[model samples]
Target: MACQDSDTARLIDVELDESVGRGTPDVEHERAVAIFDLVEENSFRPVGDSGEGPYKLKLSLVEARLVFAISRENGEAVVTHILSLTPFRRIVKDYFLICESYYDAIRSATPSQIEAIDMGRRGLHNEGSQTLMDRLKDKIDVDFDTARRLFTLVCVLHWRG
Candidate 1:
């Protein structure tokens, strides 16, 4: 993945909206938020360090910290990643799992959902695109397409310091 600065991308900050079409749904968005917060507090470890869930990110400014996790709901893997900067990045930004479970099942997702998820992942510096999504894919060692779909369910949680 390549790393490039993105001036066009805007970090998403809406409170979880379900998809409108044929893609994964957004039923677990709220639980994902809670889970992300929990993982951030108790499971901050560098990637490849061991175990699973609550994996640490590989890139960041010295003063910043990035973390991630994976949650399985109805067999779908929701990948979550968080970025924290002590000085603050003007405003706290959050990227949520675009794909989630609901109605005891997943929701009907859309291309827009994929775009939303992709937007949140812009400017990542990994072997594929430096997006946290790509990193998660590599760490999990899954196929690119599946890794992507799995990552949308990945959530991000935050606390101001």
Candidate 2:
């Protein structure tokens, strides 16, 4: 017998809105990485539901807000949460700026300088993830790593119209 981890919620399927434009290479790459990481390991448990999952999630932006439509593998709805984008505006802006700096640093700056910028980027990323966890509280239960991956996906959606 082998012990398997059951604490993390695995995403069996994920879909992003079709209306979102195909962004730059960097943006697309970020989306890919985030989705891959999210599907690989996550902690998602919808409140007030008896369903156990490996969940399916549809992520999109509607009327300037972010939405998560979660369901079981059987296609039954678990819960839907719409989160305001207002609180994330400043943090997203800062993340983008730091990301640009980090990318440029990778191309031209010294290794030490790049490391410094990367540290700042990671710090801002953590802050955004924490904000996400706070907002999702009482709605859905998710761990920090899951929140971080979801935040990346949200940023990808935010990058578009």
Candidate 3:
């Protein structure tokens, strides 16, 4: 999808709330990579003239709600969107289960079995990505890949292990 100037429409930095407990080493690695990828290349535009581009985002979960604290590159206040987590509950739960299965499969299952499990995991991830995009459509405009990375961050917030 077309976006503003590549430098301006992208995320310059991404942070997760400190209150969100850390997960297992593997999960932590995944979170780190997701943030890195998001900051490297993403198309994020806050709906309306909330602020100029090159935004910084802090993802947090508060009272069962997903909080998107966005700001300008210079630390100027932009917009904070609190979205209901209800729409993502099922997808997140299923994704976690599939991820567990895929990880376990990697250790002993056949290559084909592992591949199958991974496919399922990706399917669920895509579903979650779409759900996130749909939910944020009125708040922020994000492409599919951006939504995928954001979904990963959201899952990171939900991670308990």
Candidate 4:
């Protein structure tokens, strides 16, 4: 629902389901489908699974959430299903980069996303880490320092991989 139509999000398929929801057919969408395949849970890793053929994409709506899957079908992503369930939601580097590319993505996030982020960041910081920028002679926004730290942290994570 957070997605907009101005982007390359294309509807791929629709199918009926007896489980999960009522008579709502699963509506498959292929916006940044590659995103799903590229990001892994927690560890934030990318594993190449691109192989020959028709890419079958599926989405199922269960419990008021959207769930999707991808597979090859005929040298294309033939999304075969759609479900409503959010599971194995991973935060990979691509997701991070995607989020960074469009800061608006975060800015427009729903209340749930904000809460999720807040919950995830719990205990990741220490007390008194927050500080106001003091007037320094060099005169650079400390925000830049935060960015640098994030970049270095990503580099270190990749290096460890």
Ranking by lDDT: 3, 2, 1, 4
Using TM-score as the measure, the top candidate is 3
Task: Kindly provide the TM-score of model 3 when superposed on the true structure, using C-alpha atoms.
Answer: 0.91
The residue-by-residue lDDT of candidate 3 on 60-151, one tens digit each, is 77888988898999988789999999999999999999999999999999999999999999999999999999999878888999999889
Cα deviation at 33, candidate 3, in Å, is 2.2
Best by lDDT: 3
Global local distance difference test of model 3: 0.87
lDDT of 4 by residue, 1-161 (tens): 11122122222332223332332121122222322322211111002332332223343445544333444434344232232222212223434444343455467888777666554433122111121112111221223233223223222222212
Candidate 1 residue lDDT tens string, 15-58: 23222112223334544554444333321222332333322222
| Overall lDDT per candidate, in order of appearance | 0.32, 0.81, 0.87, 0.29
- Cα displacement (Å) at residue 147, model 1: 3.4
Q: Which has the better lDDT: candidate 1, or candidate 3?
A: 3
Each prediction's TM-score against the native?
0.22, 0.87, 0.91, 0.22
Model 2 ranges with Cα > 4 A deviation: 1-8, 19-21, 24-26
For candidate 2, give the lDDT. 0.81
